[model samples]
Target: MPIHSFLNYLALEKKYSQHTITAYLKDLNSFQEFCNNEFDKQRIIEANYAQIRSWIVALVNANISNRTINRKISSLKSFYKFLQKTKEIDSNPLAKHKALKVPKQVQVPFSEKEIRNAINLLDEEVDFESLRNRLIIELFYTTGMRRSELINLKLTNLDFANETVKVLGKRNKERYIPLLKPVQNSLKKYIEVRNEMNTNETYLFLTKKGKKIYNTLVYRVINNYFSSVSSKVKKSPHILRHSFATHLLNEGADLNSVKELLGHSSLASTQVYTHSSMGKLKEIYNQAHPRSKKN
Candidate 1:
């Protein structure tokens, strides 16, 4: 297999990030395993078109979602293209490959008042965990950071005087988001109680034992808090982010500015929040307009 050369190309020549490289390697490794099982072949360089087709069919057989399989197909296309460019293979098999179809997006987010109530519910509780939960909710709602960025946050990233926290976003890019005054006050209270816990961890959010918080723990905490506050909306960390973007859009913030704040790679990605705002506008229109209901 020319996997070595391709990996080197991705790492050094292409400069793909470690996370991306890992995903590519993982997909190739799965394909390698499939090749070994189906044709008693370990090296994929010897794989014929039929073998490649079998791998695609196998992914479908494994009940992988079309989106996931499509990503894997992309990895394969890149891998084989590397093989061909390096003169390891005669032809690029994945050039004609079809990706599995992915369904359209249908994300539903929370209303602004519902979000405030959710955070307020967390505020009513009286414990270190509760305080921390409140702080987490505030930070998510205020900053609109991704779950990974929130989990990766350290005490050092927060600047009390500057009123901002530097977040490391996707592709290892750095962005500073302004921390809201209310969120800052809650953080101060949380820190006071956190210090009382006497944990040795340097991370902002932590377990009772003093270890840094995991992504799942943060998700579950936010999920539980949101569920307690609102039965109508689906509560998740991403929803807080969605709520943030939607709220900003509703306030007549520039779309490009929101794109930069959210660290979106393109304006098209940020445009979805406009739809979120449009939905809110429709609700307002329905309540105020005489033609709204059958009454």
Candidate 2:
């Protein structure tokens, strides 16, 4: 299929992450299957709205999630657009279809106490890997960087004299977060241990063999940490970041400040933590009001 060439274009020209490319492929392949099973068509290039709409009906009948189905539809739109650009087909068939919609749930953020407990669980007596994982957790919460930004951080990014670490955020933008004393000390210790292993001059964090840390390893460390800390809350590295912004908001930090700290592209993205703060206010209001008591 010419879809393969378009996918290669996405990887090379578009510079999308492998994860995104894989997702696009999965959606395209699913559509290909739908065509074969429903319309008896083998080529994605030959598909039209009649076949694609049938795929949507199949998705609904199969009870797939609104989010998943929406993403698949969006993928089809992109695929058709790619085909159109290459003259593989004339018009984008999936463009006019309305995507499935889902409401965005407001996720609960962890409390400051939970953050403290999780960090303390990192035993200093353990080996370098243990300490490195602890420091990764610490820096992530402290800096509120996205996982990709954190993983891609280089040794040269740290500026000790100025007490700030410059992070290259999404779209090649850079931002600086302050280097707190505790974080500075933890970073120093990690760097000391990191240097003792096989030396790599570029990447900041690494395995014992001096390989760069990958997303799976980072996610595993975060998952294990979350499991040990509190089962009451949903946990991901992003949850820690949400906790960071919420804690700051609760402590009187302004929305714009939190927005910049979080590297959110828009104020709306950062405004969700304001909702968290409002929930706290509602709890206090309900507790104090005499008529608010329930039997």
Report every candidate's CA lDDT. Answer: 0.84, 0.84
Clashing pairs in 2: none
C-alpha TM-score for every candidate: 0.65, 0.74
Model 1 lDDT per residue over 1-295, tens place? 4777788888896657889999999998889998888777658876776788888788889898889988887888898888888788889777777667788775667777777887778656778888988888888888889988888888899998999999999999999999888888998888888888767787888886778999779889888877876775557899889988989888778999889889899999999888878966787789889887766
- Model 2: per-residue lDDT, tens digit, 87-161? 888899876788777988787877777778778888554578888888888988888888888899899999999
Q: How far is each candidate from the true structure, as Cα RMSD in Å? A: 7.1, 4.7
lDDT of 2: 0.84
Q: Please identify model 2 stretches exceeding 4 Å from their true place.
A: 1-47, 61-63, 71-92, 95-98, 232-234, 283-295
